[model samples]
Each structure stands twice: as structure tokens, then as C-alpha cells.
Target: MRTSRFAVTVTAVLALSALLSPFGTGSAQAAASTVSPTGTNNWSCKANAAHPNPVVMVHGTYGDMTVWNTMGPALVNAGYCVYALNYGSQATASMVTSAGELKTFVDKVLASTGATKVSIVGHSQGGTMPRYYLKNLGGAAKVNDMISISAANHGTTNTGVTAKMVGYPTCVACSQLMSGSSFLASLNATDETPGTVSYTNIVTSYDKVVTPYTSGYLSGPSTTNIKLQDDCPADTASHTQMPSDPAVIRLVGNALATNGPAQATYKAKCTW
Candidate 1:
């Protein structure tokens, strides 16, 4: 699981890597790579038959919809009707709230697009928190595929301390992120991937956030966990950068391109 940190933690690696990242440098380059589509952000945009499900971008803690500034446009350019949703204030609210809000937003998306199901691509809390909707809130009936980037699937203590020592949960969702919170225990009581939904989780080895990032791995049928470095050994992106990483984006783009057979896993050609 990736760190669900709301505040940006500037590490020396993150700073230096940003200067050399192949994904692009600053906001100017980011804008250039994420080309806008004539149909982007239009709720009425036609959904391509190849990518039938409308894609929804979910942001992490303390993050708003703008977090998808880079990826959102990319999905749009790929002929997907993409929408980004912001949940929780500073993202401190409970997963219950997150689930409800997502359901409402998905309902709106389906109504607007006349599609039955939508695909999801989430980061950090946005990645892990949605399980509640799928497992308990009837989202399994709504979502087709879920792709998580640096998500905290099994829970994480990114603060470098146990949840108990941190004086318990800082908020409702925070409790679930604790290593042994009741919320987590209940969440894992059954299959991690439950339903007809296909899932892919992406993680980076250099993440200082989601301690022991392997905690992000998902187990069950139709679920795949991707280690970004495995595909590109030279990749140096930090946890916060996963959503915008080129390698990560390539995998997402391929997965959504399900021509005749949907490939659950796709490897990127190492370019770093």
C-alpha cells in the first residue's frame, strides 16, 4: 500500500528524481504530455466501444480532483470519457462516506453516459478506500475494472509508527489504515477481490511512504499487483509520483485497451 499521506513529503530522491523523470518535468511539461481531447470533461462525451466503461479518477487524502490533471486528460485522449471525483475534507472522512459519494458520482456518470458500469483508477486512499463500496455497498454491481496506484490495500502505517502508538486513528478512514484496526480486520475477513471486478495495483520499491509497500498487494481471482520497478528496473519515481509515471500510465493504457482479449497484466519496456 502506498502512503495515504495528505501532506507532501519532499524527499531528496523525490526532488532529484523529478529533475530526471522521463514522465516529464514540471507543470509545463505535464501539460504538454496530457493532451486534452475535444470530448474531454464533457459529461456527454461518447464512450468508445473498445473502452466501453467510463473511467473515473479518484484522488487520495488531502487531494482534490486536480490530482488527475495529468492522467485525466490522457484517458480522455485515449477515447475514454473520464471524470474525477473529490471525497472527504482533507480526506479525513470515513470510508463509508467515501463509498456513498462514489456511488452517487457513479450513478451520475452512468446516467450521463448511459453505460451500466464504470472503470476506476485511484491513488493512495483513493485506491484502497473504495473496497468498502465494492464489498459492502453494492459497487461490485457498478464497477467493471479497478486500477489502484500506490494504494494501501492491506492498511499502512506510513507515519513510521504503529496505529496504537499514534493514539489511535486520527479520523474515521485513518483508523482503517492502521495495521490492526477493526475496519481492516473486517475488510480482510473475506476475499480481498470479491466479485466480477478485475483489479490491478501498482507499487514502487522506492516508496518511503507505504512502509513495506508489498502490503498493497491484492490476492484473489482476477487481481494483479504490479511492481513498477519490475517492469522498468531503472524507474526512480516516488509514491506520490506513481499516478503520473509514464511506466504506470502505459500499463493502465494497455489494460483498458482490451481489444479481443483483455490482458490483466502488461509490462513496460524499460526506458530509464
Candidate 2:
């Protein structure tokens, strides 16, 4: 039963991997600003009183900063300074190494924007990896909010089945994301949500990649776990589509609109 389940999980990851582009690819080239999404990587942007903290967007495996094209502009228009980085060779590298990269990128964002703390918005692995930075690398002191959309917070059971998938061999982070991996064991050791940062994990019932999407949820003080269907029953956004999904974006906006996590009872404005 366990082997069969693993096989199913691997199949799901392979199938969805093809759909995650514009989200990113294996290369780390800086996306062209002309073709790139709005409201990202703008170094000149400064955080204002209305939105005191600049937002740092982290992309998932096989993804880049371009993943935030939709949500990025929304936040920007809402008066936020948004930034993103291409890390882990499009986030396929070891998550530990990627966390270091995140730390360095965040430092640059802080210095440039002169903001004391930054809020983070991530998708898939993008969502889960920041916890490492926060817990192991001292990111808790610098982050105010963490809103993860379909993140593999507890590691997904999907990719550990095999490496026969096209790019699976190169995805060092994949093994780390397997259920019960040492990385996750240590990551979730004592506190899944640590420090003063508010955590909001947004999951989709239809997500196949995370294999039982509840794995994305974090438990601790100031943490909220939301299901897309809970707020909008008709919405069926999948794992990869989350970064671009309208309802998910609304949830993200709601989370950022407050000082802490998104209110559990807030109703999202559903759209097709």
C-alpha cells in the first residue's frame, strides 16, 4: 500500500511539473522586465506607512520570480513594494542552500527599501522553504508575515516515489520534501511556526502534488490554515495554478492587509 501510494504521488508531481512554467524553469536568468510581471524586483520601491513592510515573493521548484506576475501587480497596486528572487537554480537545489540564498536576497531587499521587516508570499516549495530561514537562519526577526499558497510545509509525499520524471534527478530539494525526511523532521521539530512572524497556509482541496494538501498547514500561535473551498466552494484551483488563482490572491491580499495572519473568518470575493 505504501509503495503504491508513493507511485501515485510521483505520478502526480510529474504531471503537474509541466504546468508550472512562467512560474519558472531550470535556468536562473533574470527575467526581462518588459515581459516580466508587474510589481516585482523594483529596487527603487520603498515601503510606505500604509504598507509598512515590503513583500518578498519566493517561487517553488522549477519556478522563478515570474510566478508572481498576477499576485505581484495586485499587491503593488494595493500600495506595496514587492520583490522576488531566482534561487536554488529555480528552486531545485538543496533547500538548506536555498534558505541561505533567501537570507542573502532578503538582506538586500531590506537595505534597499529601508524596511525593518518584510512580509513573505510563496507558492509550493517557495512556501515551505522560508520556514527554514525563519527557524534556522534567524529570519524570524526580519519577517512579519508568511503567506504560503499550496506550500509543502511538512514535505510532500509525491516526489519521493522515484526519479524517473524528466527533471526529478536534479531536484535535490525533492528528496528533502518527502514525508518523514530528516529535513522536515528537524524543520518541524519543536515549532512549525516560530517567532513573531504570522503564518497563513492556503491550501487547495484539489492539489495533487502535495498529496493530501493538509501537509501544507502549520500549527502554532498566530498561524492560520485555509482551504480554498471553505471560502469559495466553486473554486477549483490546482496546486500549480494557486499563484495565479483569483480567490487565492484575495486571501493573500487579506492576509497582508492586516498586521498578522489572514483572519480565519474572512470571506474571499470569489471569481471565475
Candidate 3:
């Protein structure tokens, strides 16, 4: 029964990836020149002294800073300083490299915010890319917490099919890029979840990508994985809706406000 369920999940993930393949092409670009305000006025008005770290948002594959269009402002309004950057572009001259470019951006955020460390919130590849920064680039000390939304921590197997179809090496290369390579292995070898940072993996059972949603989990003492359905029960949010899901937004609000793992109380109404 477990095997059958896993297979169904994998099939659903691949199908969702195919469905989103169209709008999912682009490097992180500034979504807009002007910053608009979200009416919540919950997180932007003042920075809670307890959680002094600013929040930095990272977008996943084919996504840019714009992915947080709605949530960023909400954070800002809730009294938290918010910033977003685009990394891991494919082009050579693009100024950033996937997984490799995170340190530079982290440095920029630290320097600009005047905060020694910051919390990271990432979506899809955005969530997975930071392992490199944490392990290789000395980011562990600088990052206070990491919140991953629909991130692919372990490499995806759907790439297996693509590998067979488009030459094994090409697919293998892509998987490594999406997750990590020997670099991640070395990091995991020392500490699967480094004690220095708090790791929270926010995933939905209905996620249509990141095959084997269990891949979103991090193995460490400080790491906690929350399945959205378990939290909201009624919320069957898919991958695309994760970033903007109101329940997710509220969960994030509660998480940031409390600075610890808190139960999600918001229930989804089957509106998706």
C-alpha cells in the first residue's frame, strides 16, 4: 500500500511539472519597480525585537523575485524588513550561478539590512539551493532559519525518464543542478541538518512537483517538516498555489512572529 501511494504521488508530481512548464521559464527579475503595500498591516509596521533577522526570499526554477509579489509586502507590512533576489540563472553572463551564487546575495542582504544574519524563505529550487551556501560558502553562521516551500531537497526521479529520453548525462546534469551534487553530499556527510540554523520544510501532500514530497524533509535536530494538509486538513494546495496560498501566508506569519514551530490553525475551504 505504501508503495502504491508513493507511485501515485510521483505520477502526480510529474504531471504538475509538465503543466507548469510553460509559465516556469525565466530568471528572477524584479517583478515591479514600485513596492505596493498589502493591507494586512500585520508584519510590515515594526520589526519584532525577538526575531531581529530580516527575511530574504528566494524563487525556484523559472521563477524570479516576483514569485513573492503578494507575500513580500505582507511580511513588510507585518513589521519585518523584507528583501528578494534572483539567483541561479542559466546564462554565463547572468551575474549569478545556481547554488553557487547564493553567498554573494546573502552578503548583499546582510550588508543592506545591517543585520548580521537573516532568515531565508525559498520556493522549489530556491529552497534547495541554500545548502550550498550554508555548507560551502560559510552561510550556516549567517542564516538563522530556513523555510522551504515545495522545495526539492533530494533529487527528483522524474528526471530519470527525461534522462533516458534526452541522453542520460543531460538529465543527470539537470537533477544535480536542481538539487545538488558532490558538494551537497559532502555537506550532508558532516551534518544533515547543521545545528547552526533552524530548518523548516513546509510542504503540501498535493504538491505536483518535487517528486516524493518526502524529499522536502531535512534530517536534523532543529529541522521540522510540516505537511500543509496536516495543518489545514482541508487545504489541498498544489505546488503552484503554495507561494500565494492564504493559509501558507498565515502560517508564515505565525512562524515568523513566534520564531518557532507553531501549529497551523487556518483551514482551507476547498476553494482551490
Top candidate by TM-score: 2
- In order, candidate lDDTs are 0.67, 0.79, 0.59
Q: What's the lDDT of the predicted structure labeled candidate 1?
A: 0.67
lDDT of 2 by residue, 115-142 (tens): 9999999998889899999999999999
Candidate 1 residues 25-99, lDDT tens each?
112112112322223457776556666899887877645565665556656655688887767653557888888
Candidate 3 yields a Cα-based lDDT of: 0.59
Give per-model TM-scores. Answer: 0.79, 0.86, 0.72
Question: After superposition, which runs of candidate 1 have C-alpha atoms over 4 Å from their true positions?
Answer: 1-40, 160-170, 259-265, 270-272
Candidate 2's C-alpha runs over 4 A off are 1-35, 160-168
Displacement of the residue 257 alpha carbon in candidate 1, Å: 1.9
